[model samples]
Target: MVTSVLAGFAASAVLIVAIGAQNAFVLRQGLRREHVLAVVAICAVSDLVLILAGIGGLGAVVSARPGAVTAIRWIGAAFLVSYAIMAARRAARPSTLNPAERTPTTLGATLITCLALTYLNPHVYLDTVLLLGSIAQQHPHRWLFGIGAAAASLVWFAALGAGAHKLGPLLARPAAWRVLDGVIALVMLGVAVNLATG
Candidate 1:
């Protein structure tokens, strides 16, 4: 059971380590020092819900549905490609100004954006609830597996937000953002390719 839990944690880490909407938002909040705790809290809780939903037979049902996973694969692939292009463009012609400086900002707006970015993306559900959940189900201690997955999310989100916050000054530079954006583009492109052939 412990091994299963650890394996699930490792699997979750593998998938979540990649750059994506959630990671971007978390890093943004961290750099801004604007409700960074809220952002991580939301992300961790969301992951818990998603991981549980997937492990509790929801994944099997979804996967059993004809073309569901296929549809998600295509949508996720397209989003990843589109996001990669956007990131690369931003990196190439980097913006000196931060977006929060110009955009109308509010807690509600930020929270909604985070939720939309995390949940609205079918890829999230497919990856966490379906793919990872399916793997957990194969383990003897499925509940422990879910717990491990949830633990990974909690730990990762907290660590990421806190670490980025610590590097706030360094990350404030325009050049740093450009580099970050480049990394984001590469991560998205790599994930897209992996999904396409997986």
Candidate 2:
């Protein structure tokens, strides 16, 4: 059981500690010092829900529905493209990148974006549902695996959101924000393309 849990933790951490839209958004929110707790909570809770669903055998149901997957893929791709455009626009106007100078988004709007980032990414489903679920089933203590995965998400989001402000000093310049948004734009578009193609 311990081994299963550890394996699940390792697998989840590996998959999550990658450069992605969700991570980028969370980091930005953290650095900006805007609703960091809310963002972290949403992400961790969302992951918990998905991990539970996967371990509870919803993964099989999801995998069996090719139509559902296709629909989600299309929706995800569309969302990614829109976000990429927004990021590109942000990059174009480096002046708005300053966290202190920019108007803070409403809580509702921030929550919506957080939810969208958590749900609209096909890769999230692929990793949490298909991959994690399949692997957990291989273990005798599947629920334990889910617990470990959920714990990983909590730790990761907490650290990312709470610790992001430490880098605020470095990203104080418009140039830094410009580069960050530019990279985000490129990554989002690339992910969008992959989703559409797959």
Q: Give the number of the best model, judged by TM-score.
A: 2
lDDT of 1: 0.79
Per lDDT, the best of the predicted structures is 2
Predicted candidate 2 versus true structure: per-residue lDDT over 122-171, tens digit per residue: 78899998889899999999999989998999999999999998998889
Residue 84 miss distance in model 2 (angstroms): 0.9
Backbone clash tally (model 2): 0
**Cα RMSDs, all models:** 3.5, 1.3
* Residue 196 in candidate 2, Cα distance off native in Å: 0.7
Q: Which regions in candidate 1 have their CA more than 4 angstroms from the true location?
A: 66-104, 178-198
Global lDDT scores for all candidate models: 0.79, 0.89
Q: Model 2 segments beyond 4 Å from truth? A: none
Candidate 2 Cα deviation (angstroms), residue 54: 0.7
